[model samples]
Target: MSDKKLLLLSSSREGQTDYLEHALPLIDGFLDKSIKNVLFIPYAGFAMGYDKYEDKVNQPFQTIGKKVTSIHRFDDPVKAVEEADAIAIGGGNTFHLLKELYDNELIDAIRKRVDQGMPYMGWSAGSNVAGLTICTTNDMPIVEPRSFNALALVNFQINPHYTDYQPPNHNGETRAERIFEYVRANPHRYVVGTREGTALQLKDNKLTLVGNKPGLVFRDGEKTRPIQCNTDISWLL
Candidate 1:
């Protein structure tokens, strides 16, 4: 990827609880201070808590003097993503996010935009798209196929929401476990299991980790060996 071309802020959870704080700066970094146009798409919210999550999110950008316009639905979503000096897709369930992207032909459009040099930011499912495959996401196939094909923005795959926590009320396998099984079966790709507050930042062929703690990179069924940012992501790339 070109320098500063794609800033991925993949979080393990939803809402503004410090997640936005970690994500919003990437937007500000991309703000073309001279230009008044910046497009923000909020469709991932649709799959999560619905419009209930919108205002709280749209508000912070306003306070920062960032011009943010929002649209929901499969209707012309790509146009909004295509023209932004920067674009951010909020967090939500990957299944619904994929449906919206596929329905609107956004999968192809996003790949095109990034190629044309648009800096795109995605939290949660949005971040997963930057990888070559959606196989690493924590989301289940609640619907049909859902196109395992992805944006292919980076050669590596992302497993956001990569928590190793197991709450008493928690049901099913932990996100980390799911990814472990995935890697066990297919031993090629390097998967980053990002815990909450942790993000994989990619810019201009440079990839770095910022936030709460260091992330884990899994390969051949073993825990990661935490490579440094200056190393071209040798584990994954």
Candidate 2:
């Protein structure tokens, strides 16, 4: 497996907190001290314009003393990835994000750079594409991507913004139940149900779950497992 550095977050905010407030510390620590310039991928931002999305992320990075350049600003998007010391993807619609990645032919470029050890960070829909496929995303398939395949920076599939909550009188499948379907269909694969406020960190080839709440793990023919904070989950790698 390639040595990839990834911080996959469930959500940018925790509860009703400010945008990216809860994750700022994590973001600061994930980025390399030498990484002054970060390449921001704003493709997942469908409803909101790219400029607004970039500006939203810009605030937090400025607080961390880093400069963020959105890929959209670059005429040669692939070149931007090659030169970036770090990469960050904001959360939005998974399908739209994948479509843009494929449209711009950035999948290979990003995978190569991250495999070479450039630190990568993503939140919500952004984190969804870090997995093998976008099949487990919680987003509606408003747009069809060339394929469901994604970055594959990690071995397991991630269901970000995972929750056990079910509204009263709702007959739809629970989040866990939806993930179970993926587990059954892809028996060999493992799915991590990362709740809001939680993140899965991969550093030095070791994967760990961070945040207060435990993340649920789904494997074929196995009882669902709960991964606590600071727990090593490299087996999923």
User: Across residues 184-222, which tens digit of lDDT does each residue of candidate 2 receive?
Assistant: 999999999998998999988889998889998899999
Per-candidate local distance difference test: 0.67, 0.91
Span of 10 residues, lowest total lDDT, candidate 2: 27-36
RMSD to the true structure for each prediction, in A, is 3.3, 1.0
- TM-score computed on alpha carbons, candidate 2: 0.97
Per-residue accuracy of model 1 over 87-205 as CA lDDT, tens digit each: 66667666666676787778887777777777777778788877887788777667644677777887878887766688899688877677778788889777877766666666656
Instruction: Give the winner by TM-score.
Output: 2
Cand. 1 TM to true fold = 0.81
* Backbone collisions counted per model: 4, 0
Q: Any runs in candidate 2 off by more than 4 Å, and if so which?
A: none
Error of 1 at 165 (Å): 1.4
